[model samples]
Target: MSASETNSFRAGRIVQLLFGIAVAAAFMLPIVWLVAGSFRPGSEIFTSLDPLSIGTFIPPRPTLANFGSALGGAFRTGLINSIVVAACTVVVGLLVCAAAAFALSAMQWRGREVVFAIIVFSFLIPEEVVALPLSAIFAQGGLQNTYTALIVPFVGNGIVIFLMRQFFLAIPRSLIEAAQVDGAGWLRIFLQIFLPLSRPALIAAGVILFNAQWQAYLWPLLVTTRADMLLAPITLGLMVGEHTSDYGQIFAASTILSFIPAVVLLGFQRFFTDSVAMSGVKE
Candidate 1:
């Protein structure tokens, strides 16, 4: 290669590397601040934003005080409730949405497209718009403040159904046909064939559902008024109105809440990427 071309290529490579680093740092800064703030006391969190200072990037003297306060009493109960809600949602969504998606993808039925359109259209509706009616329904049914109130509303998830349907649509029809030729029914085919090949999409959908339920604020706040029924976001929010705000405990609670989603994504990050990418590649 000529020197000019070589120099140009080298410059582009350097530029790309710098841009990648910048993007990564942009995404990581909030998390870094969260961890740093969690370690620092309430005093350090309100540190001046002057450029000359080390800023809030690191704790001057890190302590476990924040974690101690966050992991007990109402906070602990909140965390457990959040976990239970998310777990049940993922499991129910997995089985139900998988079945719904399977029929939408692999079956030949009348009005399939029309049904699918209606289901997918629900995804566009804002959750806040439905929160009030849902609260009333739960209250009327005597489900309010019960785990059923938490689990039932989120179980019929449109996004999960749409995502799984899209993924299933990409599966080779020949596979389903062969299974049918071998005298396998739809249930047998789904259980013994399609589901086994859909690990990535299933994991990805679970991660999405789990994250949604965990980060939820308004819905939990609306339907569940009991203190013990609170989730992470609601718990953190109530801390603000405490007799006195402890930013340290607040930050710690936020950090723990944040960590669950991060760990969930990290746990299934590979599958999540593959599921999204493959869903777009239809045969």
Candidate 2:
């Protein structure tokens, strides 16, 4: 290529990199503001909002008091409750989704394509549409205010099943055939071979499951009226009373809530990306 063309290419690459960084910063700005506000007094949080300035994004006199308050009382219980619910859901959800994905992708049963299509269709349906009916059903079964109620609904996650199924479809069929030839049963093959080889996909699915349960607010609000069973988001909701609110504590809890999931996703980001890429490419 000519020197002019090479220079143009380098310039284009630099522009693209800068644009990407700008976009990422734009997205992160709110989170940064939230963290900043959390360290300031509740009254001072919105004080700089009249005309935005550096003070808007930076707490001049920062304190740990908000975090201290956030980590105590009902909010503390809510954090623990959310953690327990999300952890339990991830464990149960992975097994259920993996099995469903395996059956759909590996087995050549009747109506396999139809079943897969249905699963795809199910994920497309908004949770809000089903939340009311699910609440009624759970109420009838006397499962409200129980951890089982929270964990059970999330175990059969359609998106996780779809993700796992896509990953499973990318696996070589020769492995399944060879295992069968060696007199290995389907369960044995799945446990010993497929599960062991699908680490990236499993991590991706686990992350998805954990995030789903972690961010769950509407459903938890509808089902559990008890303060003890309050999830983090619901607890955050309660902090905003009609008469007054505590912005500092709110932001602190929000930061902690966002931080946990961000850490989880970042920690397994490579595996998540690999799983997504592999699922996209099929032989």
Candidate 3:
């Protein structure tokens, strides 16, 4: 290539790199402030209301008082509630979604495609549309403020079923056939073979669902009226308004609430990426 072309290419790449960094900084700045703000002593945090100000983002002294206060208050109750709800949702939801996917993908049946298509179509239906009805039903049945109100509704996630089904479709039919030839029933084949092979996809889906459930605010708020029944999102949100100009406690709670998903995603990131990419591949 000509010198001009080389210079042009280098210049373009440099511009792109700078642009990317700028965009990334724009996003990271807020998070930096949030974390930094949490560590700042109460006096330092309130010196200026400007979120991006150096004084607000960087404190001369850092302390853990905010974290301790938050942990002792709403953060404690909310964190426990979130963990319980997310864990149960992952376990039961994964089981039901994976099994449904297996039946849809590996089994010989009529209208399986139609059924799956209907599910796929249901994806377009927003959860908000059904939230009111579900709330009313729960209220009428006296299930409000109960664990059933939180965990039962999410066990049959359509998107999860679709993802698992797509992944299963890429599995070799010969393996399934061989299992059947060896007198392995569908359940045995599924549990022993399919489940083991599909661990990556299972974990990926579980992590996604767990994060969603953990961060859920609206539905949980609507279902339960009790103060102690709060989850992180609602608790942290309320904390923002409770203490006037107390950024430390709010940021501390936000950090704690965000920690779980960050650790989970970091740990399973490789598996999650592989599962998502492989789900698109065909046999």
lDDT per residue for candidate 1 within 96-195, as digits (tens), equals: 9899999999999999999999999998999988999979988998887888888887877899999899999999899999988999999999998889
Please give the TM-score that candidate 1 achieves against the real structure.
Answer: 0.93
RMSD of 2: 1.6
- What's each prediction's TM-score? 0.93, 0.94, 0.91
- Choose 2 or 3, whichever is better by TM-score: 2
lDDT of 2 by residue, 1-283 (tens): 9999999999999999999999998898888899898999999987775535788787789999999999986989999999999999988899889999999999999999998899889989999999999999999999999999988989998899988998999989999999999999989988998899899999999999999899988899989999999888999988998999999999999999999999999999899889988887666
- Sorted by lDDT (best first), the order is 2, 1, 3
Q: Please report how far candidate 1 places residue 277 from its true position, in Å.
A: 3.9
In model 3, residue pairs whose N, Cα or C atoms come closer than 3 Å (at least 3 residues apart or on different chains), thus clashing, are none
Best candidate according to lDDT: 2
Which residue pairs collide, candidate 2? Answer: none
Model 2 global lDDT (CA atoms, 0 to 1): 0.91
Per-residue C-alpha lDDT of model 3 across residues 1-283, encoded as one tens digit per residue: 9999999999999999999999999998888877887887666765676756677667767888999998998779988888898999999999999999999999999999999999898878887888889899999999988888999888888888888998898888999999989999999989999999998899888987887687677789889888888777887888766447567888888887777788998998887788878887776
RMSD of each: 1.9, 1.6, 2.1
Per-model clash counts, in order, read 0, 0, 0
